[model samples]
Target: MQPITPFFMFEGNAEEAMNFYLSIFEGASISHITRYGANEVGKEGSVQQAIFTLNGQTFMCIDSPIKHDFTFTPALSLYITCDTEEEIDRLYGALSIGGAVLMPINAYPFTQKFAWFNDQFGVSWQLNLPGKGEGF
Candidate 1:
Protein backbone atom coordinates (compact mmCIF):
# COMPACT_ATOMS: atom_id res chain seq x y z
CA MET A 1 0.00 0.00 0.00
CA GLN A 2 1.13 3.55 -0.63
CA PRO A 3 2.21 5.13 2.63
CA ILE A 4 0.64 8.46 1.70
CA THR A 5 -2.57 8.12 -0.25
CA PRO A 6 -5.45 10.53 -0.77
CA PHE A 7 -8.76 9.96 0.93
CA PHE A 8 -11.67 12.00 -0.40
CA MET A 9 -14.74 12.84 1.64
CA PHE A 10 -17.69 13.29 -0.63
CA GLU A 11 -21.09 14.85 0.04
CA GLY A 12 -23.05 11.69 -0.64
CA ASN A 13 -21.51 11.43 -4.06
CA ALA A 14 -18.62 9.07 -3.48
CA GLU A 15 -19.74 6.45 -5.96
CA GLU A 16 -20.45 8.96 -8.72
CA ALA A 17 -17.14 10.75 -8.22
CA MET A 18 -15.20 7.50 -8.18
CA ASN A 19 -16.83 6.42 -11.43
CA PHE A 20 -15.99 9.77 -12.98
CA TYR A 21 -12.36 9.41 -11.99
CA LEU A 22 -12.14 5.83 -13.20
CA SER A 23 -13.53 6.80 -16.60
CA ILE A 24 -10.85 9.44 -17.06
CA PHE A 25 -7.72 7.66 -15.85
CA GLU A 26 -6.55 4.69 -17.83
CA GLY A 27 -6.19 1.39 -15.93
CA ALA A 28 -8.44 2.68 -13.16
CA SER A 29 -10.55 0.21 -11.22
CA ILE A 30 -12.98 0.41 -8.28
CA SER A 31 -13.37 -2.24 -5.60
CA HIS A 32 -16.78 -3.48 -4.68
CA ILE A 33 -18.48 -0.77 -2.63
CA THR A 34 -19.05 -1.30 1.07
CA ARG A 35 -22.28 0.35 2.15
CA TYR A 36 -22.53 1.97 5.56
CA GLY A 37 -25.49 -0.05 6.71
CA ALA A 38 -23.65 -3.26 5.89
CA ASN A 39 -21.27 -2.42 8.73
CA GLU A 40 -24.18 -1.53 11.03
CA VAL A 41 -22.73 1.88 11.65
CA GLY A 42 -24.75 4.22 9.45
CA LYS A 43 -28.26 4.98 8.28
CA GLU A 44 -29.69 2.33 6.01
CA GLY A 45 -28.85 2.64 2.28
CA SER A 46 -26.13 5.16 2.91
CA VAL A 47 -22.81 4.68 1.13
CA GLN A 48 -19.93 4.07 3.52
CA GLN A 49 -16.76 3.88 1.50
CA ALA A 50 -15.00 2.57 -1.54
CA ILE A 51 -11.46 2.07 -2.76
CA PHE A 52 -10.28 3.12 -6.19
CA THR A 53 -7.02 2.53 -8.00
CA LEU A 54 -5.63 4.59 -10.85
CA ASN A 55 -2.43 3.82 -12.67
CA GLY A 56 -1.43 1.52 -9.78
CA GLN A 57 -2.00 4.19 -7.10
CA THR A 58 -4.70 3.68 -4.51
CA PHE A 59 -7.17 6.33 -3.34
CA MET A 60 -9.96 5.82 -0.88
CA CYS A 61 -13.19 7.81 -0.78
CA ILE A 62 -16.22 7.89 1.45
CA ASP A 63 -19.50 9.70 1.89
CA SER A 64 -19.24 12.37 4.51
CA PRO A 65 -21.91 12.55 7.16
CA ILE A 66 -24.70 14.93 6.23
CA LYS A 67 -24.10 17.02 9.32
CA HIS A 68 -20.39 17.39 8.83
CA ASP A 69 -18.66 20.32 7.14
CA PHE A 70 -16.25 18.67 4.73
CA THR A 71 -15.07 20.91 1.97
CA PHE A 72 -12.20 20.41 -0.47
CA THR A 73 -9.54 23.08 -0.47
CA PRO A 74 -6.68 24.21 -2.71
CA ALA A 75 -4.17 23.28 -0.02
CA LEU A 76 -4.89 19.64 -0.79
CA SER A 77 -4.14 19.16 -4.47
CA LEU A 78 -3.29 15.98 -6.33
CA TYR A 79 -0.33 16.07 -8.65
CA ILE A 80 -0.41 13.79 -11.67
CA THR A 81 2.80 13.20 -13.62
CA CYS A 82 2.24 12.28 -17.23
CA ASP A 83 4.68 10.76 -19.70
CA THR A 84 3.29 12.42 -22.81
CA GLU A 85 1.29 15.38 -24.00
CA GLU A 86 -1.59 13.16 -25.02
CA GLU A 87 -1.98 11.80 -21.54
CA ILE A 88 -1.86 15.26 -20.06
CA ASP A 89 -4.46 16.54 -22.47
CA ARG A 90 -6.76 13.62 -21.81
CA LEU A 91 -6.61 14.02 -18.07
CA TYR A 92 -6.83 17.79 -18.12
CA GLY A 93 -9.93 17.77 -20.26
CA ALA A 94 -11.68 15.10 -18.25
CA LEU A 95 -10.93 16.70 -14.90
CA SER A 96 -11.97 20.17 -16.02
CA ILE A 97 -15.61 19.34 -16.55
CA GLY A 98 -18.06 21.31 -14.38
CA GLY A 99 -15.02 22.74 -12.64
CA ALA A 100 -12.97 25.90 -12.63
CA VAL A 101 -9.56 26.09 -14.27
CA LEU A 102 -6.96 27.83 -12.17
CA MET A 103 -4.46 27.71 -15.04
CA PRO A 104 -5.23 26.86 -18.60
CA ILE A 105 -3.34 23.94 -20.10
CA ASN A 106 -0.17 25.16 -21.77
CA ALA A 107 3.55 24.66 -22.17
CA TYR A 108 5.55 25.80 -19.20
CA PRO A 109 9.20 26.67 -18.57
CA PHE A 110 9.62 23.72 -16.20
CA THR A 111 7.65 21.16 -18.19
CA GLN A 112 6.86 20.15 -21.73
CA LYS A 113 3.21 20.57 -20.82
CA PHE A 114 1.29 21.50 -17.71
CA ALA A 115 -2.11 22.51 -16.33
CA TRP A 116 -3.81 23.11 -13.00
CA PHE A 117 -7.48 22.91 -12.21
CA ASN A 118 -10.10 21.86 -9.69
CA ASP A 119 -12.55 19.18 -10.68
CA GLN A 120 -16.32 19.30 -10.31
CA PHE A 121 -15.99 17.52 -7.02
CA GLY A 122 -13.78 20.38 -5.77
CA VAL A 123 -10.58 18.36 -5.92
CA SER A 124 -7.58 20.27 -7.20
CA TRP A 125 -4.99 18.66 -9.46
CA GLN A 126 -1.80 19.63 -11.22
CA LEU A 127 -0.98 17.74 -14.40
CA ASN A 128 2.64 17.78 -15.55
CA LEU A 129 4.56 16.34 -18.49
CA PRO A 130 8.32 15.97 -18.39
CA GLY A 131 10.23 18.57 -20.34
CA LYS A 132 13.67 18.81 -21.97
CA GLY A 133 15.52 19.53 -18.73
CA GLU A 134 13.65 16.95 -16.69
CA GLY A 135 14.20 13.20 -16.66
CA PHE A 136 11.09 11.07 -16.90
Candidate 2:
Protein backbone atom coordinates (compact mmCIF):
# COMPACT_ATOMS: atom_id res chain seq x y z
CA MET A 1 0.00 0.00 0.00
CA GLN A 2 1.15 3.54 -0.68
CA PRO A 3 1.99 5.58 2.37
CA ILE A 4 0.21 8.59 0.98
CA THR A 5 -2.95 8.34 -1.12
CA PRO A 6 -5.34 10.96 -2.45
CA PHE A 7 -8.87 10.64 -1.21
CA PHE A 8 -11.85 12.19 -2.91
CA MET A 9 -15.37 12.78 -1.60
CA PHE A 10 -17.73 12.86 -4.51
CA GLU A 11 -21.32 14.02 -4.71
CA GLY A 12 -22.58 10.57 -5.56
CA ASN A 13 -20.37 10.21 -8.67
CA ALA A 14 -17.42 8.30 -7.30
CA GLU A 15 -17.86 5.32 -9.61
CA GLU A 16 -18.47 7.46 -12.66
CA ALA A 17 -15.41 9.56 -11.88
CA MET A 18 -13.29 6.46 -11.40
CA ASN A 19 -14.45 5.05 -14.72
CA PHE A 20 -13.69 8.32 -16.46
CA TYR A 21 -10.19 8.35 -15.02
CA LEU A 22 -9.60 4.72 -16.02
CA SER A 23 -10.62 5.53 -19.58
CA ILE A 24 -8.10 8.37 -19.77
CA PHE A 25 -5.02 6.60 -18.48
CA GLU A 26 -3.42 3.66 -20.25
CA GLY A 27 -2.72 1.40 -17.23
CA ALA A 28 -5.56 2.48 -14.98
CA SER A 29 -7.88 0.06 -13.16
CA ILE A 30 -10.29 -0.07 -10.28
CA SER A 31 -8.67 -2.47 -7.86
CA HIS A 32 -11.69 -2.62 -5.60
CA ILE A 33 -15.01 -0.94 -4.91
CA THR A 34 -17.35 -1.46 -1.99
CA ARG A 35 -20.80 -0.22 -2.79
CA TYR A 36 -23.33 0.93 -0.20
CA GLY A 37 -25.51 -1.99 0.84
CA ALA A 38 -29.13 -1.91 1.92
CA ASN A 39 -30.04 0.71 4.58
CA GLU A 40 -26.82 2.64 4.09
CA VAL A 41 -26.96 6.42 4.19
CA GLY A 42 -26.10 6.66 0.51
CA LYS A 43 -28.01 5.00 -2.29
CA GLU A 44 -27.73 1.22 -2.10
CA GLY A 45 -25.77 0.99 -5.38
CA SER A 46 -23.61 4.05 -4.81
CA VAL A 47 -19.94 3.78 -4.03
CA GLN A 48 -19.09 3.58 -0.37
CA GLN A 49 -15.45 3.60 -1.30
CA ALA A 50 -13.17 2.59 -4.15
CA ILE A 51 -9.49 1.93 -4.71
CA PHE A 52 -8.04 2.59 -8.13
CA THR A 53 -4.81 3.10 -9.99
CA LEU A 54 -3.95 5.60 -12.69
CA ASN A 55 -0.57 5.42 -14.37
CA GLY A 56 0.53 3.16 -11.52
CA GLN A 57 -0.40 5.50 -8.66
CA THR A 58 -3.11 4.43 -6.27
CA PHE A 59 -6.02 6.66 -5.23
CA MET A 60 -9.18 6.28 -3.23
CA CYS A 61 -12.57 7.96 -3.14
CA ILE A 62 -16.11 7.67 -1.83
CA ASP A 63 -19.59 8.91 -2.60
CA SER A 64 -20.60 11.33 0.13
CA PRO A 65 -23.96 10.60 1.69
CA ILE A 66 -24.25 14.28 2.41
CA LYS A 67 -23.61 16.97 -0.18
CA HIS A 68 -20.86 19.50 0.24
CA ASP A 69 -20.51 22.88 -1.41
CA PHE A 70 -16.91 22.30 -2.41
CA THR A 71 -15.41 20.03 -5.02
CA PHE A 72 -11.87 19.55 -6.28
CA THR A 73 -9.66 22.55 -6.79
CA PRO A 74 -6.48 23.36 -8.70
CA ALA A 75 -4.83 24.15 -5.36
CA LEU A 76 -3.88 20.46 -5.43
CA SER A 77 -3.53 18.39 -8.58
CA LEU A 78 -2.34 15.04 -9.87
CA TYR A 79 0.99 15.68 -11.50
CA ILE A 80 1.71 13.12 -14.20
CA THR A 81 5.12 12.69 -15.74
CA CYS A 82 4.89 11.53 -19.33
CA ASP A 83 7.48 9.85 -21.54
CA THR A 84 6.37 11.15 -24.92
CA GLU A 85 4.74 14.20 -26.39
CA GLU A 86 1.97 11.98 -27.72
CA GLU A 87 1.16 10.83 -24.22
CA ILE A 88 1.04 14.38 -22.93
CA ASP A 89 -1.14 15.53 -25.80
CA ARG A 90 -3.48 12.61 -25.44
CA LEU A 91 -3.83 13.30 -21.74
CA TYR A 92 -4.34 17.00 -22.32
CA GLY A 93 -7.06 16.41 -24.88
CA ALA A 94 -8.90 13.95 -22.71
CA LEU A 95 -8.66 15.94 -19.50
CA SER A 96 -9.51 19.26 -21.10
CA ILE A 97 -12.88 18.13 -22.39
CA GLY A 98 -15.75 19.77 -20.48
CA GLY A 99 -13.31 21.31 -18.00
CA ALA A 100 -11.18 24.40 -17.56
CA VAL A 101 -7.59 24.61 -18.79
CA LEU A 102 -5.27 26.33 -16.37
CA MET A 103 -2.42 26.20 -18.87
CA PRO A 104 -2.41 25.22 -22.52
CA ILE A 105 -0.24 22.37 -23.74
CA ASN A 106 2.97 23.93 -25.00
CA ALA A 107 6.72 24.03 -24.77
CA TYR A 108 8.08 25.43 -21.54
CA PRO A 109 11.56 26.21 -20.24
CA PHE A 110 11.45 23.25 -17.86
CA THR A 111 9.83 20.75 -20.23
CA GLN A 112 9.40 20.21 -23.93
CA LYS A 113 5.70 19.58 -23.46
CA PHE A 114 3.25 20.33 -20.68
CA ALA A 115 -0.38 20.98 -19.83
CA TRP A 116 -2.56 21.70 -16.81
CA PHE A 117 -6.26 21.18 -16.71
CA ASN A 118 -9.19 20.09 -14.61
CA ASP A 119 -11.21 17.11 -15.82
CA GLN A 120 -14.98 17.03 -16.03
CA PHE A 121 -15.09 15.88 -12.42
CA GLY A 122 -13.07 18.96 -11.39
CA VAL A 123 -9.94 17.01 -10.61
CA SER A 124 -6.90 19.02 -11.58
CA TRP A 125 -3.99 17.43 -13.42
CA GLN A 126 -0.64 18.50 -14.69
CA LEU A 127 0.98 16.53 -17.50
CA ASN A 128 4.67 17.13 -18.05
CA LEU A 129 7.27 15.64 -20.38
CA PRO A 130 10.63 15.61 -18.70
CA GLY A 131 13.66 17.26 -20.25
CA LYS A 132 15.89 14.92 -22.22
CA GLY A 133 18.35 12.93 -20.09
CA GLU A 134 16.09 13.50 -17.08
CA GLY A 135 13.77 11.07 -15.32
CA PHE A 136 10.08 11.26 -16.13
Candidate 3:
Protein backbone atom coordinates (compact mmCIF):
# COMPACT_ATOMS: atom_id res chain seq x y z
CA MET A 1 0.00 0.00 0.00
CA GLN A 2 1.10 3.53 -0.70
CA PRO A 3 1.86 5.92 2.13
CA ILE A 4 -0.91 8.30 3.08
CA THR A 5 0.30 11.88 3.25
CA PRO A 6 -1.62 14.76 4.77
CA PHE A 7 -2.79 17.26 2.16
CA PHE A 8 -3.76 20.93 2.31
CA MET A 9 -5.68 23.06 -0.17
CA PHE A 10 -5.39 26.81 -0.06
CA GLU A 11 -7.08 29.45 -2.13
CA GLY A 12 -3.92 31.35 -3.01
CA ASN A 13 -1.44 31.34 -0.16
CA ALA A 14 -0.07 27.82 -0.01
CA GLU A 15 3.48 28.95 -0.57
CA GLU A 16 3.23 31.40 2.29
CA ALA A 17 1.86 28.74 4.58
CA MET A 18 4.55 26.26 3.57
CA ASN A 19 7.27 28.81 4.23
CA PHE A 20 5.79 29.70 7.58
CA TYR A 21 5.83 26.09 8.70
CA LEU A 22 9.32 25.55 7.43
CA SER A 23 10.61 28.43 9.49
CA ILE A 24 9.05 27.05 12.64
CA PHE A 25 10.20 23.44 12.50
CA GLU A 26 13.75 22.15 12.39
CA GLY A 27 14.93 19.91 9.54
CA ALA A 28 11.98 21.01 7.39
CA SER A 29 12.37 21.75 3.70
CA ILE A 30 10.48 21.89 0.46
CA SER A 31 11.26 18.88 -1.72
CA HIS A 32 9.54 20.24 -4.80
CA ILE A 33 7.18 23.00 -5.92
CA THR A 34 5.34 23.83 -9.13
CA ARG A 35 3.96 27.31 -9.56
CA TYR A 36 1.09 28.44 -11.72
CA GLY A 37 1.94 30.34 -14.86
CA ALA A 38 0.07 32.89 -16.94
CA ASN A 39 -3.28 31.70 -18.36
CA GLU A 40 -3.39 28.90 -15.86
CA VAL A 41 -6.44 27.89 -13.85
CA GLY A 42 -4.91 29.18 -10.65
CA LYS A 43 -3.48 32.59 -9.91
CA GLU A 44 -0.22 33.34 -11.65
CA GLY A 45 2.81 32.45 -9.49
CA SER A 46 0.66 30.69 -6.94
CA VAL A 47 1.42 27.16 -5.87
CA GLN A 48 0.21 24.65 -8.42
CA GLN A 49 1.36 21.71 -6.34
CA ALA A 50 4.08 21.12 -3.80
CA ILE A 51 5.59 18.45 -1.61
CA PHE A 52 7.39 19.28 1.62
CA THR A 53 8.80 17.65 4.71
CA LEU A 54 8.55 18.71 8.33
CA ASN A 55 10.61 16.88 10.89
CA GLY A 56 10.80 13.90 8.51
CA GLN A 57 7.04 13.77 7.78
CA THR A 58 6.01 14.39 4.21
CA PHE A 59 2.99 16.54 3.32
CA MET A 60 1.40 17.81 0.14
CA CYS A 61 -0.32 21.10 -0.61
CA ILE A 62 -1.79 23.03 -3.50
CA ASP A 63 -3.20 26.39 -4.37
CA SER A 64 -6.69 25.50 -5.50
CA PRO A 65 -8.16 27.10 -8.56
CA ILE A 66 -11.69 26.91 -7.26
CA LYS A 67 -12.68 28.42 -4.00
CA HIS A 68 -14.64 26.33 -1.51
CA ASP A 69 -16.78 27.29 1.45
CA PHE A 70 -15.12 24.64 3.59
CA THR A 71 -11.69 24.88 5.17
CA PHE A 72 -9.52 23.21 7.77
CA THR A 73 -11.14 22.32 11.07
CA PRO A 74 -9.99 21.31 14.51
CA ALA A 75 -11.32 17.79 13.95
CA LEU A 76 -8.21 16.85 12.00
CA SER A 77 -4.91 18.14 13.36
CA LEU A 78 -1.14 17.79 13.10
CA TYR A 79 0.16 16.40 16.33
CA ILE A 80 3.68 17.08 17.58
CA THR A 81 5.33 15.33 20.47
CA CYS A 82 7.87 17.80 21.83
CA ASP A 83 10.80 16.72 23.91
CA THR A 84 11.05 19.68 26.23
CA GLU A 85 9.06 22.52 27.74
CA GLU A 86 11.10 25.04 25.76
CA GLU A 87 10.15 23.36 22.53
CA ILE A 88 6.48 23.24 23.41
CA ASP A 89 6.50 26.81 24.63
CA ARG A 90 8.23 28.15 21.56
CA LEU A 91 5.94 26.22 19.24
CA TYR A 92 2.83 27.27 21.11
CA GLY A 93 3.89 30.92 21.05
CA ALA A 94 4.66 30.81 17.36
CA LEU A 95 1.56 28.87 16.24
CA SER A 96 -0.90 30.66 18.48
CA ILE A 97 -0.22 33.99 16.88
CA GLY A 98 -2.97 35.20 14.51
CA GLY A 99 -4.88 32.01 15.27
CA ALA A 100 -7.52 30.64 17.56
CA VAL A 101 -6.55 28.56 20.53
CA LEU A 102 -8.79 25.65 21.38
CA MET A 103 -6.73 24.85 24.45
CA PRO A 104 -4.10 27.20 25.78
CA ILE A 105 -0.72 25.88 26.77
CA ASN A 106 -0.77 24.44 30.22
CA ALA A 107 -0.37 21.29 32.23
CA TYR A 108 -3.15 18.78 31.75
CA PRO A 109 -4.02 15.66 33.64
CA PHE A 110 -3.17 13.54 30.63
CA THR A 111 0.11 15.30 29.90
CA GLN A 112 2.72 17.52 31.43
CA LYS A 113 2.38 20.37 28.99
CA PHE A 114 0.06 20.72 26.02
CA ALA A 115 -1.61 23.13 23.63
CA TRP A 116 -4.09 22.97 20.75
CA PHE A 117 -4.75 25.69 18.22
CA ASN A 118 -5.53 26.51 14.63
CA ASP A 119 -2.80 28.33 12.73
CA GLN A 120 -3.33 31.47 10.65
CA PHE A 121 -3.90 29.22 7.63
CA GLY A 122 -6.62 27.35 9.51
CA VAL A 123 -4.49 24.29 10.11
CA SER A 124 -5.08 22.63 13.43
CA TRP A 125 -2.11 21.57 15.53
CA GLN A 126 -1.47 20.03 18.91
CA LEU A 127 1.80 20.28 20.79
CA ASN A 128 2.46 18.00 23.69
CA LEU A 129 5.28 17.41 26.15
CA PRO A 130 4.50 14.03 27.54
CA GLY A 131 5.46 12.92 31.00
CA LYS A 132 7.49 9.83 31.68
CA GLY A 133 5.74 6.56 30.77
CA GLU A 134 2.93 8.56 29.13
CA GLY A 135 1.96 8.41 25.50
CA PHE A 136 -0.66 10.00 23.31
Which structure among the candidates has the greatest lDDT?
A: 3
The TM-score values for the models, in the order shown, are 0.86, 0.90, 0.97
Between prediction 1 and prediction 2, which has the larger lDDT?
Answer: 2
The alpha-carbon lDDT assigned to residue 136 of candidate 1 equals: 41
Off by over 4 Å in 2: 133-136
Give the CA lDDT, 0 to 100, for residue 133 in model 2.
72
**Can you write out model 3's per-residue Cα lDDT over 1-136, one digit (the tens) per residue?**
9889999999988999999999999899999999999998989999999999999999999999998999999999999999989999999988889999999899999999999999999999999999999866
Q: After TM-score superposition, what is the CA distance of residue 41 in candidate 3 from its true location, in Å? A: 0.7
Query: What lDDT does the true structure give each of the candidates?
Result: 0.83, 0.88, 0.94
TM-score of candidate 3 against the unseen true structure: 0.97
**Whole-model lDDT, model 3:** 0.94
By lDDT, rank the candidates, best first.
3, 2, 1
Best of the candidates, TM-score: 3
lDDT of 1 by residue, 1-136 (tens): 8388788888778888999999987789986578876546565565688888988888898886665765888777888888888888888988999998888899877777888888999999988888867744
Candidate 1, residue 127: Cα displacement in angstroms equals 0.3
CA lDDT, candidate 3, residue 131: 98
Q: Write the per-residue lDDT of candidate 2 for residues 1-136, one digit (tens) a residue.
A: 8389899989888998899889987789999999999997998999998999987788999999997888899999988888888888888888789988998889888778888989888999998998887545
